[model samples]
Target: PKTVLLLFASGKLVCTGAKSEEMVYESIVKIHGVLEDYDLLFKDE
Candidate 1:
């Protein structure tokens, strides 16, 4: 099953439908990695 992520304009996110907590973290990490690969992640100085 695929997880669902709900992102808010307030910079808050909710990950749901995951089988376990680890799955949630993994999903987030994967997403972050992809964003990084595409240079879509914001960097703060």
Candidate 2:
């Protein structure tokens, strides 16, 4: 199943319909990592 993740420009990350904390955390970390790889993660601007 594909997890639904929402990334906002306001620095809010939303993980929806995850059955467990591990799932949510994993999704968040994975997305965060990919974004970081592309230098698209949040910045302190």
Scored against the true structure, residue 31 in model 2 reaches a CA lDDT of: 84
Give lDDT tens digits, candidate 1, residues 1-27: 378887676657899999999999988
How would you encode candidate 2's per-residue C-alpha lDDT over 1-45 as one tens digit per residue?
258988777888788989888888888888878888999855596
Clashes of each: 0, 0
Candidate 2 worst ten-residue window by lDDT: 1-10
- Global lDDT scores for all candidate models: 0.81, 0.81
Name model 2 segments beyond 4 Å from true: none
Could you tell me every candidate's TM-score relative to the true structure? 0.68, 0.77
